[model samples]
Target: MRKHLAFAGFATALLMLAPPAVASADKPEPRVSGSMSGTLPKEFGPWAGEPVKFTIDAHGRPAGVKGTFKVFHDRIDGSKPVGDFEGKITCLAVAGEVAVATGVITKGYVNILDKPTEDVTGKKVSFTVHDNGRDDRIFWIWEFMGAPVNDCQGTAPAFKPARGDFTIRG
Candidate 1:
């Protein structure tokens, strides 16, 4: 009888030590998508486009980025979308010199900085999204005339960058 009792106790202890299983629903999906209307700075001459509309699509999970993104830049002539492309955001996070959050974006890593002048509700932040494979398609938000402009990327001078007014929904 004592041996049987010991065995039962061991069994109960084992069960209690076991880790609880979590359902798939418990995990939240990782996705960042939004749009913004901002300026596209002209790197060289004194030419900056007015605030324009641009969209973003980033989807993935915690610590893992397996999503895509699309960018559309309007021409100064009010003609076609001179800047545009659909690519994958292999990594996603908000981390860098500022230390906001770290994640991989469309092609490379990005450093996101929140704007103090604007409230967090408007999602005012800075972005420096670059590509790991190439440094040509990098985008960043920097202080332009006191305010931050969200368009600039290239070899000589980075052009057009919209503001970071995208809201996190998902």
Candidate 2:
């Protein structure tokens, strides 16, 4: 019984000398979390006369985000082509002024063809967000600087423009 007690005491001392299992407090802070989405106004140059909608769904604090872009034509008559885009994205916060995200479209479709998604699948799309520090009335928006469509297939819009703005009002 005395030997058993000594062995147990030694084991308890060893455990006290061992390192901790996790170090969560030593890790850096995670990125902010939320979703941002909105529609492009008619004056948006690239989609001047079309109704385009954009969405940026953040996967997590660091897995980046996935975006969905769509455009619809004046179609009570069903006489126009639709544009759709979906893929992964990476965003970087500016010097306290903006958050810029850019990535390639790797999925989704446009019109009757999947060309737009395929064309830009491996290509890059740049999106920018300007937060005026006010969440009152439509101030935080992500703007598209450039997203070109290449290697198109089937019946599709000849020009793929990527100059529109998206907003998340909360």
Candidate 3:
């Protein structure tokens, strides 16, 4: 009779300590996608200016050119894109033709960068435009610029376009 009581107590304890069985199998992970778009202001400065309003298409192409400018992204610390900019008219004309255009993220803000990394073969000093858009090829570039560490930190940096150079292309 004592053995029966001990066995009953042991079974009760085991039942209480056992974990509940899972109801179903684990669900699959979710897939994420990135997007880009914006508008360019009628007047703006390439540097030393505020964020100009520009309509950046989903394909990452800039239209309405009033002046000569070139835009591209640069990888900072070999980790991710930290900065990008639209080059001056003279620079863009000399750099090369616009082969491909696409929107991308370096640190966080939407930016346009080169399509083929192999095409951007140059000294890593400043942003350079490798492809010209005259060819009419659709390109897409997207990257996640990490979030800020603190409130004191500023938002992601982006390239500024000079005023009187905004022109829309067909």
Candidate 4:
């Protein structure tokens, strides 16, 4: 009876520790997606509004990003979209509530003085998405205007939205 009791206690301890490892292994990676539209500095003329939609799935390994980055002048409002940039996001690096996604602009276009022009092609686009409720801010790399940060790493820029909504999940 004494030997049997000791074996049962050891078995119970083993059973208790076994499930957690299995449970953790079964955990799935968080999904990443967002719809963001915000404003940039007016001093940077010809381009004033920035809108990004991150709707993608398992890209390579850990995370994926797919979205359209568009820009419009402040005067246009809801009329038309200028600088429609669509591409595959190459890198998505996250820290806390902020995520920086970077990719090359496979295809893009802009309008110069109401004339459609093929511009901003083959350029790197990196943007930051903040997922902190009210404090949430949406912003991206303005390479033409010399944005401070590029690629999806380290500290990034966060621009408070003067309009639209941003939904980011990770």
Evaluated with TM-score, which candidate comes out highest?
4
For model 1, the superposed segments whose C-alpha errors exceed 4 Å read: 1-29, 41-47, 94-165
Question: Taking the tens digit of each residue's C-alpha lDDT, what string does model 4 give over 61-159?
Answer: 244444444443333465455556566666766555766766666666654456756576667766676777766675567454345545564344556
Please give the CA lDDT of all the candidate structures: 0.40, 0.40, 0.28, 0.55
lDDT of 2 by residue, 1-97 (tens): 9999999999999999999786365543322223333344555544445544445543223333433332223322345545455666554332233
Which residue window of length 10 is worst by lDDT in model 3?
A: 87-96
lDDT of 3 by residue, 53-170 (tens): 2222211113321222233333323433323433211111111222222222222232324432222212111212222222211122222222222211222224333322122222
Ranking by TM-score: 4, 2, 1, 3
lDDT of 3: 0.28
Q: Give TM-scores for every candidate, taking all chains together and pairing residue i with residue i.
A: 0.38, 0.41, 0.16, 0.56
lDDT (10s digit) by residue, model 1, range 1-170? 99999999999999999999753655545444555555655643323663345455665544565544454545566644433334444444432211111222222211223323321222222333332122212343323224543312112213333344343423
Off by over 4 Å in 4: 1-31, 38-82, 112-116, 143-150, 162-170
Evaluated with lDDT, which candidate comes out highest? Answer: 4
**For model 3, what is the alpha-carbon lDDT of residue 38?**
31
Root-mean-square deviation per candidate: 15.7, 15.3, 19.5, 9.6
